[model samples]
Target chain A: MNLTAEEKGILQGAQGKGMQLALSTLVRYGEAFAADRMVEIHSAHLAGSFGAFIYRTYYDAIRLMVKEGLKVKVPATLNPRPLEKIKFLDRIMISQQGFLEASLAKLGVTPNYSCVCYDRENIPPQGAMLAWAESSAVQFANSVLGARTNRNSVTIDLCSAVTGKTPRFGYLLDQNRRGQVLVKVKAKKIDFPALGFLLGKKVVNRVPVLEHLECTRDDLKNMGAAMAASGAVALFHIEGVTPEAPTMKDIFDREPDEIITITEEELASLRSFEKSKPEMVVFGCPHLTMSEVKTLGEFYRGKQVKLPTYFCMIPRVRQELGGTDLLRDLEAAGVRVTAQCPLAAWTIRALGRKTILTNSGKLYYYLHKSEYGATEDCLKFSGVSS
Target chain B: MKELQGRGIISGQATGKALVTSQPLNLTSGLSKPWNLFNRLAAVYYDRHHELYKKDLYNRVLVFPQTIGSTFTGMVILETIRRGRAPLAMVVQQADTLLTSGLILAEVWLHKKVPLIEVPDPQLFNLIKTNDLVEVNGDTGAIRIIG
Candidate 1:
């Protein structure tokens, strides 16, 4: 497979037992994709934040790596913890949270604890190679930021971080990055997440290039999250919005293999469940940034939520908004703010499994019981922006 | 006897009744329900959104289009294997990184392997069905429908 001497040394156990195992797995994983050589990665984002006691083997594996003094060669960040202040859930299931935190810390993770790892501190340059996990982050980075990374699984994500190498195939190669599907957006209102959900279902696991959709960065982020959830879409491009696809000819090799239109009514159907009022509302499935929080804060300005409303933010981003009046204003309106993963938080059956209303299509796709809603509609049910 | 050839991503051999579904399986969300914790017998497929909802996956040849959802897919899958409650082997329409991660980790580090094969043919679902005895050889990428 044309492994470098150093890689070969690691595979032959010249580095250590843990190092050997990590490299060996990458080689095997790469061979499956027909990757002939390894590419060095600029950074990594891990999705191994869940530390439930049910995952003893995972914990043991992490412990072994830590014991072997295995550390990330490049900068790294983590996904959110499974349980964050939801005391109603079973504690025994996640008894190993602290152990995992310590293990990851020893491995030199940034502890930002958000799926949106590229937000501020760890933004990689365009065309930078990465070995990131978390479907949403991989999609956003590949699509929006034009970074190259395949959807490396959780353990593989960590292994790439430790070794600073990934199999050079899939999205890392230029040929595979070309958009295979042409997605025409006929939606009048362009509900970002819902549009993304529709796009994902239509073009599963294929790169899609969107046409005639004027979108903001936050809109793209939310849309990409949903796309990754409903489908295995790791990368997508909007006509001029994303880094790669500036024009039709720029992103596609030929006329797209498939073309699908997403209309306002189709998006409405995805959010049709908004008719059934949700027991609670959630936002930030990919973890909201400060700008997103401020936008929603204006909706909650001088208003209280009708039902249980929660805003999940990246811990660092939440801290960034700490002293802002928007944070103060939202707190005054009784909107619960926490740095947690809605996908993980809402999935706990102990939370009584109530129907959830979320603006995040990713959450709608994953949460045990969730309904898609527009920003105003979700806020309407929560007695905001009235 | 019915036979098909495909690519084997993980190497092993096992035989079990096929639990076939055309839908993509989100192993992370599917097995995360409290049912797996409560049931000592088998890893219950509890994702209500899936077509194979509330079915038992233990020691069966789990056949699906592919896996979807979070990177946590690997660990959830590994945990099931550790608990002796996973499918004997998996035959997927396309084996992505998430589905193969946990099994590969188990094989490399934990010395426990579950044969995972990828049959890219669309007609694989048409031939296999639930309750049909299936034999899978991960080394040769051979799947036999031995009813």
Candidate 2:
């Protein structure tokens, strides 16, 4: 890869050992992909913050960097941990969380603790380059916001955050971002998450451009998250919806490589709920935005929940909604509002086996069979159980 | 003996029993016991694949099409290696950055080696089956099947 003189200097150990190590790691990563150059990144969002005890090495590695006095050059945000300080963890979990917190604190990273860092922490300008690690966030940044980024891994994001640079390849190149397949939406009411799940399975790493569908920002967010979970899709174009692609022609330079239409039946087929009663209902796999929380509050007003329900959001969003009448009403309805990442929280063995109902397709895909019970979405999950 | 060539993501050499799968593995949840704390065994909860669920991944040749689920997969790979439970080498139909980043971290920080090679050939999967002894040359991008 072509490196600037400064990058070469850092590589030559002109900078600290931490910087040298960071650049060397990135260079190897870039070489694996045959990347020829490095691009400046506007911002970065890192994962691996949960510090789950099994990942002690990750914490130790970061701690070494911190001890070496290496700091992030660009604005950086962290992914949510299992809990902030709920105090239910055993001795081992507590120790792991402590190590993770200390390492991040020493690095001076923002305590955003959100997968949706683009929404709350830092919103890059259109076409701005980024090095973001969270799957859903990377897809949203690339597909919805028109910003460029690859589905960076946790360590790569850390390196990019410190260096403010990433290898210029894959999604960073315009050629790889063009729509490879054309998908038409034929459903009356768009199930954004299901649509995303379907698109991801169909495309499998190829970029798809949606046609003849109108979707909101939140709709795109849900769709992108599910797509990233089900497939390796980093970026997608929705004609007349997303920023970059105003029309089908704008997304694809020529006729799309292939075309697929999504019918109402196809969308319906994606929903398969076998559980009769749900032990828990969860929302916000991508972390709820303020508007989503408000809408949920309005929907459940004066209605008592039959099962335990949890509303997960980032700390900032929780703070914004705290002490509000909406929050109070939801809490009164027996809804538990916490900033914990449900994905990580469910992994706790203490939770045990229980059927979980959620609105997030990504959550459904991950936790369906592994947790010893079925996982379904709220809409269908509500019909059969409640 | 059969040999296949592709791009090499990490450079090293090793031979181990092969465990091949057509489905993508979610290394983060598939190979982790973060909740168990004291349990050093990874992926004890991964039930998606009956063949791999709760199976030992330590020093085996993990063969798969690609990786799916979670950006934390890279971190999981690193942790698995740190616990001495990582695959001896990885052979994938298509190489992804999420898996390679972990191997890269191991090499850079820990001086440990877990070579990865991509064999995009469709027949490559048909040729290499579970329990087959396979040798990998990451620097040369070669995979030799030896009985």
Candidate 3:
């Protein structure tokens, strides 16, 4: 791997112990991927908000960096914290949260503790090189915003942030961003997240270009999350919708290597919550934005839910929706809104044997007891009516 | 003794019973929840969607096509290796970034090196069995399927 003089200096312990270790970590990681040179990134989003208690080595490494007064060289945002404001949260994980939070704070990371970092904090322009983590965010940044990054692991994200550069390889190259598969959506009622789920299962690890589809920005977010969860899909295209693929020729140089058609039946076949009523409903796997919160809040306006329901939103959403009638309605309907990652918060152990009904295919795919439910179905099951 | 050559992603050696599967493992969803603290399920493969559900991943030569799911998978693998609950070493058909990230981090940051071999051949499944004792040498890129 070719390193700049300054990068070489850091590896030779010119920057200090923290940087030396961080750079060495990147160098090894980069060499594995056969990256020729390191590319400076505009920003980074980390997948390191939780897992400190069990990830002792990870936290210990962070503590060392924090002690060294090391700060992220680039603008960095964080993933969700553990679900602290809930009943089923594991107490042990909660107790360990403060240390990680403090460590992240000292690292000079932006306090945007959510997965959808592109929506607000650290939004990258078209073709911006990034070292972001969190699969959903990476997908959105690459496909939706036309930013470039691979599905970087947590440590890689951190090391890149510390050095402000990621090894140039994978999605960083223009040729790699081309769509490998053609996915045509033939579903009558499009469940964007479900379609994403199916797309992931079918085209695992390949970039898929959707031919016939129109979806909102929010739909893509939820769908992208599920795709990353069920499969390792980092970037996907909507042909006419996504930033890069304004036309089919832009993303596809030849006839797609393969083509798959998705129907509503295929999506419905993925739903397992039809028979048994769910005990709880979870709304966010890649936490909801303020706009999504306001939109979903309309369903609970003057009604109560039969089952426990939670809207796992970003902290910024709650802050923006503060003192509003939407928040009041959601609260009155007994909707527990928390700024935590549902994937980290509601584990299979947390909801052992109990069924979870969710609008997020990402959550449904991850949680063993969770089942997929459409927006209306989730509302109907929760005893909410228009 | 049947031996095979592959590429090494991490440098270490470990021998253990093989937990062989053709399916790509989602290490994130596979080992849900946190570590040994609340994670009594310690390194057990609990992804209900997977064929290896309820199988313990601890101290085994985990063989799979690759890994899928959340990027948080890196932390889970690192945590497991830290807690001594990770597979003895990973022998995979394809070594993607997520799998390498964990073991590499464990190696570079924590001084804990777990052997990771990328066979890149689909034929790897034909040679190894579920309970067969296998030795993997990451430094030499050597794999021994021993009975």
What is the TM-score of chain A, computed separately for every candidate? 0.97, 0.93, 0.96
Q: Lowest summed lDDT over 10 consecutive residues: which window, candidate 3 chain B?
A: B32-41
Q: What is the TM-score of each candidate against the true structure?
A: 0.96, 0.92, 0.94
Selected candidate, larger lDDT, 1 vs 2: 1
Tens digits of per-residue lDDT for model 2 on A170-218?
8888898888999988978777888887888788778998885776787
Q: Which stretches of candidate 3 lie over 4 Å from their true place?
A: A86-90, A348-354, B1-3, B14-16, B33-41
- Local accuracy by lDDT, each model: 0.84, 0.79, 0.84
Cα displacement (Å) at residue A146, model 1: 0.6
> Candidate 1's residue-wise lDDT over A129-198, tens digit each?
9999988899888988899999878788888888889988889999999989898877567889998888
DockQ of each: 0.69, 0.68, 0.70
TM-score on 0 to 1 scale for chain A of candidate 3: 0.96
Span of ten consecutive residues with least summed lDDT in model 2 chain A: A368-377
Better of 2 and 3 by lDDT: 3
TM-score pick, better of 1 and 3: 1
Query: Per-residue alpha-carbon lDDT of model 3 for B21-125, expressed as tens digits?
Result: 998899877676444346643888876657898898888889988999888788778878877778889898878888988888888877898899999887888
Candidate 3 versus the native: TM-score?
A: 0.94
Measured with DockQ on alpha carbons, how good is candidate 1?
0.69
Off by over 4 Å in 1: A86-90, A273-275
Model 2 chain B: worst 10 consecutive residues (lDDT sum): B34-43
TM-score, candidate 2, is 0.92
